[model samples]
Target chain A: MTGETVMFWVLAPLTVFAAVGMLLVKKAVHSAILLAFVMIALAIFYIAQDAPFLGIVQIVVYTGAVMMLFLFILMLVGVDSSDSLVETIKGLRGVAITTSLAFAAALTSLIARAEFGQEPLGLVSANANGNVEGIANLIFRQYVWAFEVISALLITAALGAMVLAHSPKSSEARLSQRARSVARFRGASIGTAAGLPGSGVFARHNAVDVPALLPDGKPSDLSISSVLAERGDVQETKRYALDGLPKLDEEDK
Target chain B: MTEYASLLLDDPIWLVAVKALLIFVLCVLLTLLAIWGERRIVARMQLRVGPNRVGPFGLVQGLADGVKLALKEDLIPKAADKVIFIIAPIISASTCFLAFAVIPMTGKVLFFGEETVFQLTDLSVGVLYILAAASVGVYGIVLAGWSSGSTYPLLGGLRSSAQVISYEIAMGLSFVAVFMYAGSMSTSEIVDSQAQWWNVVVLFPSFVIYVISMIGETNRAPFDLAEAEGELVGGFHTEYSSLKFALFFLAEYVNIMAVSALATTLFLGGPAAPPGLSFTESWLGGWFTFIWFILKVALFFFLFVWLRGTLPRLRYDQFMKFGWKVLIPVNIAWILIVATLRLMTQEGASQFMLAGFIITVVVLVMLATTIYESSKAKAEAAARFVPEMPEPSFPVPELPKQKRVEL
Candidate 1:
């Protein structure tokens, strides 16, 4: 097989698998990652098809910008939040299945009927004056209005987001609150004293200011102590508390 | 494909493999040298002695570290996603190598009785290919963080992804001017276009922006907040150990080299000799151009190390703000001016007049905006003024004065 054919065969299946995996993956993060893989695969496919401009655009725009945004949002939301399996709306799953099946069938039929070897009308070969120039020509000349409209739509979307998220009165109130907090903080010593507990069992000082010492003369409520206590591994704790602090004897009380 | 690039495809399979192998070896050796150089340079900057034990001047210290890492016990956190944890470092290290594939090391050189460019491969969209590879490298870090199932790592990964995305936008915008000037994205073609003047000379603003964005993009010092040791404690690789950790380290240094090479390719004219220098060209039978390329790349590497030694990491918010607000907007404006000038010059217009006109317009617009912004700020300050509060109704208790004791 030719290199292009070989590449197509490899990348096409991988792309399909990744697309399917994106839906099948339980974790939202994994799905987002799989979508990125799909995008990269599609970009390779574009390159193999001699459309270097489209391939690069696919990578730069879809895989790089959009998928990164998706992953960013997903990670921020936390990976523990998996996709809910429950059907929120009655008959929604059925509707989805039906629509997807119909769409798939329509797409399959359209592809099967399409001419594979012939170049499309008004579309220049990628080798002619470079793919970038050819694509630019098409974009700025033939499809200029559509491109402009799409860009305008993006701007409008951004505006709508601002309108939805912003409120002048609330923002002003928040700003005033923030100013007050800042003033309060400035009036006091910029220390951890504000977070200290008032009292504790071994309270010589505030709990947050000074960690309480346990009867064993080890610091109480430390991360190591908590983790060890949770795991019920007290024997392992001795290795961690090897700082050579004197242990409190029972008679010393 | 351009004639320069076409020859690359016509190379025999074994030659291509040899070139790929050479690139791999060069990247690794550069990473090692960079590590040693960074340590030695930073130590000198700090007035301290660096590694001098392993080999002469600690040149083999990187090798020692590699051996040490390989010998160390590999540890996987109990909660980590096993598959992803394994794949993450591989992704990082591989992508670092991938970006070097299109970087031309030298002009046409005789290879076993055939002329070929000193590069692995040349794509039509070579620069974009590098960018794509760099972008994909983000995945390795993000995945490593997420798969660790830890807090600091997740935060680091998130920070890095956001940082990469923000900087990538600026970096891409900066490239637009270079593309306009070069009239092609292919690295070899760009190098050819720089026969008269390097892109850095013509597209100074883009170069500046690219340098800043490259630093941010590579997550080097001053922009390495993702792995800020003071806060994140090793960051995304916190949960990794042994060879995996080494992979992350290797990827980091390789990324530095790749980015430096890219800057060399795009701005410093990619293996081309400096203008009006022909003595060195004949000294090594024309192989001296490769040395020039290496020197330019090394200079960039030194700059990276110097910044690391001199500067402190930027706060995350400030870094993001600079990337999105300052670098990107400035890059866009610069690109617009450059593109206009290029079009005018191409159409037989006076280059000086067109450039001057664009610069004048840009300056006037900037001045107008600055004045308007300052006035608006003054108005806001006036509007935000608050009257002082009256005295409290309840009497405040006064503390008793401490008795003065003189020692």
Candidate 2:
């Protein structure tokens, strides 16, 4: 077998596995990651088929921007929010299975009946002037109108998203930085006027989880983030204490 | 097809393997040097001696650091997803090296009695391949953040992903001009097309946009919001320790080199000798071209270090705004002008006419910018002129009715 066929045999099963894994994965983040893998594998297939331009675009546009955005939203929405098995719509699973099966069968039949006039003609001749140039000629010359229409459509979609996402600014006067600072100092207590002390400011260990030590040799509750404290991720300060140094009382004596 | 691509295609399997290995080693070595160079250069810029105690001139300081990092205790946070946490760095480190595959690092040179270029392979879509590799690299940081199962890392990861996405658009837009001018995306062809004048001179705006975009792309300062130490702790690698953290560090530096090399290839003319130094191209059996390439990359590397030393990190909102609102629009406008110029040249426009066209475009752009700035300033001034300040009103609670008796 040729190297291309060998590579195809190696990658096809993995791509399929990853695609299937995306659905089976419990976590949305993992699903997104698996989808990225599938996209990358498809990109390789494109490259192997002599469509290097499309292959790279598959990677740049799909795996890169699109999948990254998917993962980004997943992170924002909380990655731990796993899929719910409970169907929200009545007979949804049945409908999904039936449609998927029908689609698969149609795809199989289409592939089976596909005709090859002779030995397949590769893109070598078309890409003689370089893949990008060849594609550009098609895009800018023959199919320019179609390309322009597609671009217009994309721009419209982008604009639509912008309009939907945008919210009008509040009518109330916004506080300037100076005003905010002045208000901060004048509020309930000025104890934290400058700012709340950062975690591990005066601690032996300066890790984020290590709470700073107060003057009386006690850990300050306000030093570490409340989230971290709530989660019980804070490190024990006893081991990190500067025991080698003389005590304050002894120094005073 | 370019000479380099054709040559690369004819390379036997063993030669391909050797070239791939060579590229991998080169990247790793460059990463090490980059790390040390960044520290040393930044230190000198700040008037401090850096890493002087390590091997000669601290040349092997990065190696020392690698060893130290590997030997350090590895920690996996209790909450982290184990499998993904391990894979994240591998993906990052691997993809950075992948970008090097298409970058022409030298002129045609003899290696082991076979003629080859100092590159793994050159795709017809070479520039796109580099960009694709870079995009894939984002997954490393994102996965690192997500799998860490921590707030800081997660926030860092999201910020990085967003930053990369926005900047990648501007970066791609900048490349549009280069592609239009060169008429090819292959790195070698682009380099060859710049025989007389580099893209940096002809496509100055694209170069500027690309340089800015690349800094943001690699997550370097002042665009290094991904690892903003103050706010996000260690950012996406907050929970990473030992070798995993080292991998991220290696990937970060290697990515810087990758982008720098790309900048060299696209704008500076990859592996080409500087002006008035044409004779040097024949030196060392064309291996000198590799040296020239490295010098160009080093120039960019120094720029990265200088920026890191000089500029403070940009606020995340401002950085994002700059990328999307400013850089991208400017890039698109530049591409339009470039495309028009390319078309004019293709249609045999005279030098006088071309010069006049360029002058007209520049003047119009300048005039528009001035007008926009003035209008923005006027709006700001008008907004600042508030008529009066409202009385500060805060909610107050009344004392309990029976409080006096209770007290």
Candidate 3:
């Protein structure tokens, strides 16, 4: 194998492996990180192809932008421990393994039929790396339609992503909230005592610690600060959360 | 390709690696300096010293601050996802640093006996590489925000991801015009093809689009919603402390410098002297080429600084609308115009006829733009003149109320 070919074969499998691993990863955030490794490897592949621009674009766009979006979303939604791959595929393991093997077999056949070129193509050697002048001629005349098609695809994808990113949290909460919110009053019984601040996650979801309505239905603006202050003040805040979890354990046992 | 004895040996892998390392270091240094320069320049524009003390000329101030950040206890919020919290910044910093490998700073230079291109590598799909790199860079911000396991950071990351995506399309389209005009996407080839007229001149519309898109892509001022200092409170990096925060900052500034360098290369001509000087045979010509490159890059850098100082950040909605409604569509129309020009040239159409067609297209575009601007302005004025709506007792959240809890 040529140095270029050697570089590519080694890197390409790693890239594909990482990308597949990203798909298989349980934690959404971890999946995003795996996707980044795949993206970086793909960029190296682009560099090997003598397409530095595309490699940079791959890194900048897929690794930087798209994966970041995925990560942000995972973060935004709160880590979905429920979506853990192992957990998701618990019952489907046998079928999944069979399907994956079938897919791999088909892929191998396709690769086996591909023709090999005798020599490595280089921007320097061939001056035929067929860059600006070559692409200009080809794009203007031959591949113009393909170019426009890609642009259209990009436009739709951009809009779709934006819409998805901005999706409201309403349906998620209303539909799945009760099942998932678990509020961990789980099969594990909770103490009847409710006044201890961090009995549950202690409002990890919201930072907006405003006042509540009094029993008399009067506004209690004064209590907002007082309540919030007491939650943290002379009494150390960290202990409440640490202390809260064990209390549930005690009640359950 | 002629193999360089200096570079081909095992020792030189380390050497090239060292050089690459130096370039990365220089880029980060430049970014910090640019940040300081931007502040000081803006302060001068507004009549103030940006960051005096810490060191003379505040020269050492950026460095001093960097050292201070390093010395400070690296605080990992107890709530943050520990592994990702560490990895995200590395991704951002490394990707930004890697982008420089392809940018031709001073064109070809002698190394040992062989002629060597100043670029780290060339690729037929070079432009696409850049786009991909930038896309990956966003992950760092988004992941950092998400892994922080904090509300604000998550929100900031989400917003940033959206912002980058929205602008990236326009940025890609902007490059299409360059690709069309130059014919190749290779950095060196594109630079070479602009032997006569820098694509900036021939493809001025594309140049304008690229300039706008580059700013938006880099998340510069007026478009920096990802880390909106005012609202998100340092945005994605809000949960970060010490070296983590510095990495994010370094990535931001380094990316800024990379994009500026890219703009200078693509539009202004990479490392080549300006048209007149490159062609001139004087010993001064070669010397001047390096000088011209730095000058051009500096100018573009200054523009970034100026925009940060002058423009207030756009509202998130308006920013997206501008990208989708204005920039993308306008780029499409401009591409059509460029396509027509390319067709005419290919068909061996008469120069006069082509010129007339071009003139007509230019006039129509300008007229349309003017009419659109007037209508937009008129709408703005009419809205302002109309009575403001009474404050609602409870302003409806833009997001669905059900989301209020999940969010």
Candidate 4:
């Protein structure tokens, strides 16, 4: 077998497995990652098939930009958000299964009836100048109209996203830096005028979980982060107080 | 496949393995040297002593650090994703080395009596392959951050992915100018086309854009917001320890070298000698060209170090704004001009026409920028104007007279 054949055999199974795993993965992030794997594998297949331009574009546009964005949104939404599996619409599962089976059967029959040789027809002549130039010629000449339409569609999609995301400024005039500073200084309590003390300030222990100590030997509530406090990860300062520690000489006895 | 690719295709299996091994060693060695050089250079810039302990001039400091890291206790956070946490660093380290495959480090040379180019494989879309490798490299960072199951890592991961994705567009757009000039994406062909003049001279704007984008793409200062130490506390690797942390570090340095080498290939004309010293290319059976390649790559590495030493990390919002609003738009405009110029030249436009076209475009761009700047300034001034202050409604308190007593 040729190297390409060997590579195809090695990668084809892995690609299928990854693609299937993408659907089965519990976490949305995992599914996204599996899909990325499948996309990359498909890119390799393209390169192996002598379509290096398509292969690299696959990786760049799909795995790189699109999948990264997918993962980014998943991260923002929370990685623990998994496939619901719950049927939101009535008879949705039945419809999905029927459609997928019909599509698979149609695909199989079409491939079986296709009049192609065992060996792939390589793009050796078409890519005589270079794969990039060959693809460029096709894109700018033969498929120019389609390409233009696709670009228009992309621009419209981008505009739609921007419009959806854009939030109109409120009627209230935005506060200037000077106004913000003046308001802060003139506010109800002057305690946080400079800013709240950072966590672990004057606490000896510099970890974020430790709250700063007040002058009256009390822990300052404002010093520790609310997140840590709410998570119950805060360390009690009394345990590390100097008075509570054993003396070195007493420990020797 | 191009000539270099056909040459690579004729390679024996053993020779191919050797080439792969050589590329692997080159990358790892470059990573180590980059780490050492960055420290020494930054130290000099800061007027401080860098690593001088262990091997002479601390040349093996990176190696020593690697060993120490290996020997240290490996820690996995209780809440971390076990499988992905383990795979993340491996993915990070591997994808970085993959980019070197398409990067031609030298011209034809004899490797164990086999004539081969000093590259693993030269795909027709070689440059795109590098970009693909870089894009895949992002997964390593993102996954490391996510699988760590911590807040800081997640934030750092998101920042890095966003930064890389934003900058990759500008970087890709910059390459379009070079592709136009060379008329091919294969690394070797591009290098060959630059025999007369380097792309750095012909495509200066693209070079500048690529340099800036590469810096941001690699997450180096002043674009290192993703792993800002003051904020993220070691960023995505906060939850990692020992060897896993080392793998991330390795990947970071390897990525630096990868992009630097790519910059050298695209802008500095690959492994070609200096213009005046072009004769030296055929010297030593074409092996000396590898030295020139190293020198060019080293120059870029120094630039990376210099920027890191001189600049401060940018604010996240401002950095994002600069990438999207500044770098990308400029890059797109440059690409359009380049494409039009290429088209005109190919259509056999007269010299006078080409010059006039270029001059008109330049003047128009300048005028548009000036107008845009003036309008923006006016809007900013209007926004800064504060309304007239009103007099206090309540009466002001009178100061006590002659209350001070001299001691």
Candidate 5:
């Protein structure tokens, strides 16, 4: 066999194995990193075609930026929970394997059967520049709008992520207020709600008026701090109020 | 057939591998030499002896240090991600070494009864390869930080990763100008493109942008926010010890050397002597260009040391802002200018007319922008500071002749 065929055999398995490894990885982050390996393998495949520009772009854009973004999103959402297996299905697994195998079989047969072969164009020929400039020249002239729309979509995704990540100003303030009110209501005179302590739905001489926007809107005085206390960890964040510094230490008593 | 296999058949695999190995070794030695040179030069500047305890005016100081570092007790923190921690330094060192494969240290020399370049190898996509190598080094730092299971190291790694991404965009934009001028990315062909005149002259703006990017790329001051000593304490290598620590150190120096070598190759006309000095004559053999190349690299090496000594470290935000805001935008503008000039030249425009027109246009644009921005900024500054009119100060503090005590 020619060296080209030998090289192809070596590289083809690498790409397929890496891609399969990427898909089969249990941890999402590991999967993403494996996908980078697959992208690098594919980049090498492009190198075999002498499409160096596409090869570099494949590695740079896919492995570098997009995968990094995916990893970041996974980290932000906190992967590695037992909830991941909640979507697992035995029937889907069988179908996935069968379909993927069939697809691979069809693709390989098509490749093997094709009589198409190419030789590198001469140095001064039209194909010499790897179509980077030529494609750009044509693309900007024709599909510029689509390219811009893709860019806009990316911007929108970025903005959406930013919006989702940010806590609304009013809700955080409301939570902080709830915690502070709990601290304020540890008095003996108040009609404390159902709890072990004298803390909760307090009444000062028959005056127990709690704010709306808490659970179920009515002034059932369901006691916001009691709810937060049940939740546990958010107490520190509740203490992240406007100068809870002195009062928080007092509440510990 | 001529194109497909002639190049491969010209040189045997063993010979090429040997050259590759030699290039790797040479780059390491170059890095060692650079570290020593910087210490000695900085010491001289500060009027002190540097590394005199080592062999012969501290000539082997770097070697001694390397050996000492290897002998130190290796400490892997209990909390670090063990696999990534182990892999990080290797990744760092390997990527830094890979960039030199395409850098022609000398022109074609006769080897093994065939003509083969002194370079390890040259690919059509050599420039992008260097970019990839440099970019991969960022991951090593990132991995180092993340693996360490320490806060400061992680911060250092993240900062470095961001810094790499920020600077790389500007660096890529700068390459567009070079590509437009040379019409190729192959390093050897790039050098050949500069056979008439160096790209450093025609693409000076690109070279400048690349210089800025290189400084940021190598994490030189004032761009070394990744390892800011005051804030990060040892930065990404904080948790590393012994051979691992040494690898990170070696990687840092190797990257510095790689960038200097790249600058030498790209702008200083890779192994070629300056204008008027031709090694084409038989008296000056092909091997001699390597000397000139080394000297150019040494000059850049000195510049790196000089920057470290001279510039204060920039704030992290300011560093990123400089890369993304100033450098990338300026680079894009420069690429446009370079492309326009290329178009003009290819269309048979006279060099003098083009230069004159470009200069006038640039000067006018710069002047107009400066006036607009400065005027706008002046008002903003006035509004912010709101400087009140100053009254003459009385030394007695307007206390109405209270107590003549100069005591």
Candidate 6:
């Protein structure tokens, strides 16, 4: 087989495997990353097919921008928050499975009916006048209206996102309340700061920026979620404890 | 000499491999040289004696550093996702190298008694390919940061990805003018189009925008908030050590070189000689064109170092605001103006009509900008009015005055 064919065989399976992995992964972050792999594989397939412009666009727009956004949100939200198994909508799973299977069957049938060996219709070869030009010619000359409509749809989506994200009045009220609290804090005496300091036996660290260290030299707070802590997700050792060495077993003694 | 050189047209597989290998080596060497050059230049600017121990004037300091990195013990944070953590640097380094494939290093040159181009490979969508590689490079950083299972690294990765995406839009828009004028996305064709005059001379606005966006795109100083030492520690690679850390560092320098090479290819005219230098053609032969390309790239590298030494990092919010609110809008406006001008010229419109159209567009744009600025000022004035709140009273302690002493 030619190198291109070899590449296709390798990438196609990898893409499918990654897509499956994305669904199977319990961690949302892992799923997002797997999706990126799938995207990159698809981009390579586009390049193998000589659709250089499309391939690059796939990487740039989907794998790069979209997947990064997904990963960013996933990281910010933390990884301990797994999706609940409880179904919010009754019978939704059954409905989803049925629709998915029907769609799959229809797509398979369509693909089986298509003539794979024939030259593509209404599309110039990528190398003829260069891929960019060929694509541009089609978009501008033939599919101009569709292109403009898609762009309009995109703009509308952006506007909708802005409207959804905006909450000006509530935000302003929250900001004012925060300002009032800051003002109140500024007026309070040093001793009254942090709302009645811990008892002398449990004195907190004086520095505001650093995490408070307990008297025994352990960090007072863990930044990770409680769920993660319960699952033993904390990797770094809390402290070096010389006294915590295991006592001799009773049987051995 | 050929006006333009096409790439990978029926070349043997062995020849293609050789070209790829050559470009890879060249990029690696350039990155190392750039590192040493940056340190020396920045030191000179700061009036200090830089590294001089490794080789004459510290030329081999980068190599020494590389060896040290290789010998050092590799450390992976226990919390890290092992698979993604390992692949992150590989992705970064590979993508950085990939961008060079489309950069035209020289026009046709004699190689084994056959005419060949001095580029690894070129695609019809050459500029887009470079852009794609750059975009993909962001994944390396983001994944590294996320897989580290650390807060700062995650933040850094997110910032870097956002910064790249925002600036890329402006960068792509800036290229619209160049593409319109050159009539091709192929690097060699763009270079050939600039034989008479460089794009920087005629398309000054696009040139300026591209330079600014390129700086942002590469995460260089004034736009390097992603890895800001004061805020994010080592940023996305905070947990990486040894060869992995070295790979991240290598990727950064390689990215700088790739971006500089791209800037050279796009605006400065890839491997073409400067307009007034006829002596190069007669005395130095056509191969001397590569020198011109390297010199242009080096100039950009110098600019990067200069900015790093001079400027303070911008605040993250302000950086984002400037990118999304200012650069992108300005780039779009500029593209529209350029498109109209190209259309007018292509239509062979009369000089009067062309001038009239230009004036009308400029006036309308100015009017719109002025109105927007006025409204923005008004909004700022309104938002500055914070509601006054009564001050709370608190008891204070007094200290006794100390005894006075003679000065």
Write down the TM-score of every candidate.
0.83, 0.83, 0.70, 0.85, 0.73, 0.82
The digit string of per-residue lDDT tens for model 3 on B1-407 reads: 12221222323454466557767767877877887788789999898978887677887788888889988888888877888889899988887876787676655444443345445665566666677767767768777877788778888888887887788888888888888776666677777777788878888878898889888888888788878887889888898878988898898888888887888878887777776665632344234455667678789889988887789889999888899999999899988988998988899999898989978987997899899899998765544442223333321223322323565
Q: Interface RMSD for every prediction, one decimal?
A: 11.4, 12.5, 21.2, 13.3, 21.9, 14.5
Ten contiguous residues minimizing lDDT sum, candidate 6 chain A: A197-206
Can you give the lDDT of residue A219 in candidate 6?
A: 47
Better of 3 and 6 by lDDT: 6
Q: Write the per-residue lDDT of candidate 4 for residues B1-407, one digit (tens) a residue.
A: 45666788888889879889988888888888888888999999999889989799999998998899999999998888898899999999999999888888987788889998889877777898899999998999999889898899999999998999999999999999998898788888898889899999999999999999999999999999998999998788889889999889989988988999999999998998998998898989999999999999899999999999999889999999999999989888888898998899899999999999999998999999899999999877756655544333322222334244689
Residue runs of model 5 more than 4 Å from their true location after superposition: A5-15, A24-27, A72-253, B1-9, B279-284, B349-360, B372-380, B383-407
**Stretch of 10 with least lDDT, candidate 5 chain A:** A207-216
Instruction: Report the C-alpha lDDT of model 6 over B1-407, residue by residue, as the tens digit.
Output: 12444335756777878888888899889988988999999999999978888988899999999999999999988888899899999999999998888788876676555567778776777898888888888889888988898789988888887898899989988898999999887787788788888999989999998999899998889899998999999888888999999999999999999889988998998877788884674344467878888999999999999999999899999988988898888888888888888998899989998999889987998899899999998766655545455555433322234334689
- Candidate 6 on A41-158: residue-level lDDT in tens? 8888888777878988998889877887787787778844566678999999999999999999999999989887966654455457766778888899999999999999999999
lDDT of 5 by residue, B1-407 (tens): 21212343467788888888888789789878878998998897778878887888888999988899999999988887677789889888787888888787776566566666677666767888888767656667767877787788877877777777778888878888777666777787777777788878978878888888888987778898888999998888899999998888888888888888888778888888788888451234467777888898889888888877778888888788888878887787767776777788789998798989789878988897999899998765544442233333211212332445596
**Which runs of model 6 end up more than 4 angstroms from their true locations?**
A80-90, A108-128, A170-253, B1-3, B7-10, B372-407
Off by over 4 Å in 1: A105-126, A166-253, B1-3, B350-356, B362-366, B369-407
For every candidate, the chain B TM-score is 0.91, 0.93, 0.85, 0.94, 0.89, 0.92
Residue-by-residue lDDT tens digits, candidate 3, A52-171: 555665676666656665665566566544373454656598887899999999999989987776666556754364444444566777899998999999999999999988957665
lDDT of each: 0.82, 0.86, 0.71, 0.86, 0.72, 0.80
Measured on C-alpha atoms, candidate 3 has an lDDT of 0.71
1 against 6, candidate with superior lDDT: 1
Grade the docking of candidate 6.
incorrect
- Better model by DockQ, 4 or 5? 4
In candidate 4, residue B299 scores what lDDT? 94
Q: DockQ of candidates 1 onward, in order?
A: 0.17, 0.20, 0.16, 0.20, 0.06, 0.19
Worst 10 contiguous positions by lDDT, candidate 1 chain B: B391-400
